[model samples]
Target: MMQVIYDPLLPWAAIWASAAGVVLIVALALWRRLPGWWLRGLAGAALLAALANPSLQDEAQTPLSDIVVLVVDESASQTLSDRAVQTARAIDEMERAIAGLENTELRVVSLGDAPGDEGTLLMTALSEAVAEEPRGRLAGAVLLTDGRLHDVDRAPDLPAPLHVLLTGHEDDWDRRLVVENAPAFAILDEEVTLTLRIEDQGQAPAGDGLVELDVAVDGGAVRQVRVPVGEDLTLPLTLTHGGTNVIQFTTPAAEGELTDRNNTAVVQINGVRDRLSVLLVSGEPHPGERTWRNLLKSDSSVDLVHFTILRPPEKQDGVPVSELSLIAFPTRELFLDKIDEFDLIIFDRYKRRGILPAIYFDNIRRYVEDGGAVLIAAGPDFASADSIYRTPLGQILPAAPTGRVIERGYLPELAPLGERHPVTAGLPDLAPPGAEGAPGWGRWFRQIDLDPRAGQVVMQGVGDRPLLVLDRVGEGRVALLGSDQAWLWSRGFEGGGPQLELLRRLAHWMMKEPELDEEALTATAEGQRMTVTRRTLADEVGELEITGPDGNVTTAPLQEVAPGRFQAEVTGPEIGLYRLSEGDQSAVIALGPAAPREFEETVASGAALEPVVARGRGGIVRLEDGVPSVRQVREGRPAAGRGWIGVTPRHAYVTSDVTVTPLVPAWLFLVLAAGLSLGAWMREGRR
Candidate 1:
C-alpha cells in the first residue's frame, strides 16, 4: 500500500513567509486591474506549495490466516444416541474444509465432561479458544454438540459470527427420574419425606400413563409401585439404623428412551437418633455411681431414668417402713409395662435381694431376648451366692462368676477379641508410663473372676480372667463389665484413660450402631472417589466387589489397615450410582450429587444457544441433515444457508516491508512557480 509523506525544507515558519508574499502579490494584481490577476494569484499559490514539501508512502504486506474455532463436545451427554457419531463426522469434515480454504486455519478445541457433575461447558471452551488467537484474525466459531451446554452465560462477545452444528436426531426423546429434594439426615425409626418426580422430554410418549417405580433401602429387597408420570410423588421413608442409609429409587426405562442413565436416582440420607432412652438402675451408691450418672447425663440426647436402691428390703434397723422418705420401686411399671419403650436397660451392682420376685426377673430375661439391650456393670456383689447371675437372668448372661472376687489391684487390658472389636479397637492407648503396651492406661482394683458361658471375651483382668463379655440372645444384645473400678480412671488415678470414649462406644454398640457392627461392608463417596471398607471380627477378609454405574463389576483386594478393619479405594470416570459387596454383605453408594447435571436433561435441543447464534447473525443446522458445506462469507452478514455454513473473511494481514518517497521534487515545484510568475508579468506589460 502507498501513503502520503512530508519532508519540509524550511519548517512551518517558511510556509508563513510564503503565505504573506502571495497575499501581497494578489492585492497588487487586483488594484492595478491587471488582466492576468487570476494567473498571478495561481503563481503565488505554487510558490507556497513548493515551500511545504509532500511525499507518497508505499509498503509491502503479507496476508495472515484467519482463525476459525471448531469446538467439539465430548461430555457425558454427548455420548447419548447418535450424537457422538455425528460429532466425529462433523469434526473430520470441518477440518478438511478449513484446510482446503486458502489463508484459513481450523483451531480444534475438544471439551470433555465438566468436572463434578457440571454439564457440557461449550461456551466456556469456545471463549478460551478464541482468547488464544488475535481478535482481528478470528473468522468465526463453529460448535458441534448436543446443544445442552450448562454454562451458556459465559459466552464471549465474538468478533465474527457464531454457528452451531447440533448433533443427535431432531426427534430424540428421553424419560428421566428426578429427586427434587431429599434430606441428607433423618431421625432413626422416624418417617421422613422424599420428593421425587418422573418427567418426559423431547418427543415424549403421547399418554400420561403410570410407570413402575422401585425403591430400596441400603441393599435390602426392592419394593415396586405404580406411579403416574410427570408428577411429583412424596415418599415416606423410615431409617432403621444409626448411620449412613442409601435409599435408591429406580424406574424401568420406557420404550424409545434415549438413555437409561437417568432412569435411576440415589438418595443418601444419614440416620441419626432422635433421643436415646436409657434405664439406669444402681443397686447401691458407690464411687462410680456419680461417674455413671455424670456420663449418661452429660449427653443431652440421652433420656436417663435412674433409680438407686438406698436401702434393701433385707436391711431393717428398727425403723418404721411407712415413715421412710424413699418411694416404692415400680417393678411392674418398669420390668413389665414399659420395658420395651427403653432402648437399653443398665444394671449396676445388683444382688438378688428380696426386693423383686422371680416373675419380674423372668420378664427382664424375656425383654433381653426380644430385641432389647442389657448392660451389667458388675461389682463384688456378683461373686456372692445371692448374685443376680444366680437369678432368672443368668440364662442370658454371657459369663458366670466362679464365686471368687479378687481384691488385688490389676490393669484392665484388651483381649484378642477386643483388638478386633469395633467398641474397643482404636481407643486411645491408656497404658501408664513405662508400660509394656502403648496407652497402658490406669489400673483397677478388685476384679470379679468369671468363666465364659457364651459369647466373646473382649477384656481381661487379673490372671487373664474374663473381665468384659458380649453376647447376643435371640435378637437382643448383652454386655457385662466384671469390675466396678472403671471409676479409678475417671478420677484421674495414675493418669486418666479413654474412659468416656470407651463407655460411649460401648453404649452405641449395644444400641446397634451400624459403624460398630461386628461384620459389615460399607462405602463412602466424596466427589468421584470412593472408599470401600469391610469391618469384621475375622482376621482376614475376602476381596471387595464393586459395581459401577455402567454395570461393570470389578474386584479390589482389601488391605488390613487396623486389627480387623479392611479398606480400599477407587475413582470413577463418571458421576452416578455405585454398588459394593463382599462376602454376604453389600451396600450402595451414590457418588457426586444425587442428580448429576449431565443427565439432568439428555434430549438434544438448540434453545440454549439460539440467542448467541442470533447475536452473531449465525444459523443452527441439525447434523441429521448432513455436515453442512463450508463457505466464505463477508463480515456483518448472514452466515448460514440451507445446507451450508459460512465463515466470515477477516482479510487480516501483517506488514513485511515499506518504501516512502516525495510525490513531487522541490525543484519541479519551484520551476513551475517561476514560469507562471514570468508569464503573468509579460501579460501585464503587453496590456
Candidate 2:
C-alpha cells in the first residue's frame, strides 16, 4: 500500500499564523496595485510548504488467512437418531470446502455436554472460539448441531456472520416425561402431590393421547397408570417410611420416538415423621426407670406418655384413692384402643400384674406383630413367677428368661454379630476386649439369664449370656435388654459407655429408619462418579451390578470398608439415573438431574440460534436436505442460501515492513523560494 504523509517541522498553530501573515502582505500589495504581489505570495507559499514536509509511504504486507469456526455439537442430545452421522458428514464437507477456499482455514471446535447439567453450551463454545481469533479475520461460524443449545444468552457479539447446519430430519419426534413439580421432603404416611406432564415434540404421530406411566418407590414394584398427554397430572403419593425415598416415574418408549432416555424421571423426596409417640409403662420404680424417661423426654420430636405403677391393684395399702397422687393407668385407651398410634411401647421392668387383662396382653402382642416396636428392659421381675413371659406377650419375645438372675459386675460387650449390626456397629468408639479381658465401656452389676429362642444376640454379659437380643416379628420389631443397669452407664459408672448414642441407634433401628436397616444398598454421586455402598450382616457381599442410564450393565467388586460395610466407586459416563443391585438389594440414584437438561427435549430445531443468525444476516440449513457448499461473499450480504453457505473474505493483512520517501527535498523548496523572491524584487524596482 502507498499513501502520502506529512512530517511538520513546526507546530500547527505557528504554521497557520505564518500563513495568515503572508496572506495579509499579499493583500496589501494587491490593494496598492503593485506588479510583484503574485510573485511575493508564491515565494511565501513555497517557504511554508518546506516547513510542512510531505512523504510517500509504501508498506510490505502479508495477508492473514480467514478463520472459519466450525463448532460441532457433540453433546448428549446430538447423538440421537441420525444426527451424529449427519454431523460427521457436515463437518467433513465443511472442512474440505474451507480447505478449497484461498487463504481460508477451518477451525473445528468439538463441543461436549456442559458440566452440572447445563446441557449443550454451543453458544458458549462458539463465543470462546471466536474470541481466540482476530475479529477482523473471522470469516464466519458454522455450527453442526441438533440446535438444542442450553446457553443461548451467552452468545458473543460476532464481527462476522454465523450459520447453523441443523442435523435432524423434519419428521423426527420425541416423547419425554417431565416432572413439573415435586417436593423435596414429604411427611411420612401423608399424601404429597407431584405435578407431571408428558410432552411430544416435532412431527409426532397420531395416538390415543393416553400414555402408560409407571411409578415405583425405592426401586420396588412398579405401578402403571394410563394418563392423558400434554396435560399436567397431579399424583398423590404417601410415603410409608422415614429417610430418603426414591420415586421413579417412567413412560414406556413409543414406537417412533427418537430416544427412550427421557421416557423416565426420578424424584427423591425425603420422608420425615411428624413426631415419635412413645409409651413408657413402668411396673415399679427403679433407678433405670428415670433413665428411660429422660431419654424419651430429651428428644423434642418424641411425645412421651409415661405411667409408673406406684400402687398396683393387688396392693390394698389403706390409702384413700382420692388422697393418692397417682392417676389410674388407662389400660383400655393405651393398650387396646390407641395401641397402634404409639410408635414404640417400652415395658420397663414390667411384670404380669392383674392390672392389664389377658386380652390386653394379647392386644399388645398383636400390636408388635403389626408394624409396632417394643423394648423390654428386664429386671429381676422378668425371671420371677410373675414374669410377663407367662402372658400372651411372651409369644413375640425373642428370648425366654431362665428364672436365673446373675448379680456380678461384668462389662457389657458386643457379640460378634453386634459388630455387623447397624445399631451396635462402631458404637461410641469402644475398643474390643484386650489382654485384660474387658471392653472399654463401663460394667453392669446384674444380668438376667435368658435362653435364646430366636433373633440375633447383639450383646453378651458374664458367661457369654445374651444381654441384648433384637428380632423382627412380621412387620414389627422387638428388642430385649437382659439388664436394667443401663442406668449405670448413664450415671458414668466405671467410665460410662455410649449410653446416649447406643439408645439413639437402638430406638431408631427399632422404628425402622432406612439408615439403620440391617441390609441395604445405597449410592451417592459427584458429577459422573458414583459410590455404591452395601450394608449387610453377612460375612461377605457379592459384586455390585450397575445399570447405567443407557441401559448398559456392568459389575464392580465391592471392597469391605468396615466389618459389614462394603463399597465400590464407578464412573457413569452419562448424566441420568443409575440403578445398583447386589444380591437382593437394589438402589436407584441419579448421577445428575433425573431428567437431564440434554434429554429434556431431544428433537432438533434452530429456534434458539435463529435470532442470532438473523442478526448477522445468516441462514440455517438442515443437514437432512444436504450439506451446503461454502462460498465467499461480501461482509454485510446474506451468508447462507438454499444450497450454499458463504463466508466473508476479510482480506486482512499485516504490515511486515514500511518505507517513507519525502515528496520533495527541503533544499529544492528553499531554492524555489529564493528565486521567486529575487524575481519579485526586480519586478517592483522596474515598476
State how far residue 421 of model 1 sits from its true place (Å).
1.2
Q: What is the lDDT of residue 459 in candidate 1?
A: 84
Cα lDDT of all candidates, in order?
0.87, 0.90
What does candidate 1's lDDT look like per residue over 1-687, in tens digits? 988877777878878887888888789879979988878888878777777778887889999999899998898888887777888889899989998888999999998887787778889999899999999999989988888888999999998989999988878889889998999899988999999999989988687578899998886899999999888999999888878888888898878989888888888888999999999999898998888899999999999999988777778798887776477889889988999999899999988778778888888899988888999999989999889998899999999999888998777888989899988887655444664433567778889889899988888878889998999899899999999989888887867667888888888888888888888988887888988889989989888888888888988899999998999988876677778898988888888854578888988889999999999889899999998888899988789999998899899889999888877888898888888889988998898
Over the stretch 98-207, how does candidate 2's per-residue lDDT look in tens digits?
99999999999998888888888888899889989999899899888988988899999888889999988899999988899999999999999999999999999998
Best by lDDT: 2
Instruction: Indicate the worst ten consecutive residues by lDDT in candidate 2.
Output: 428-437
10 residues in a row with least lDDT, candidate 1: 429-438
List pairs with backbone clashes in candidate 1: 3-57, 5-55, 429-439, 430-439, 430-440, 430-441, 431-439, 431-440, 431-441, 432-440
Off by over 4 Å in 1: 7-52, 99-102, 320-323, 428-438, 670-687
Per-prediction TM-score to the true structure, in the order listed: 0.94, 0.96
Question: How far is each candidate from the true structure, as Cα RMSD in Å?
Answer: 2.7, 2.2
- How far out, in Å, is residue 395 in model 2? 2.2
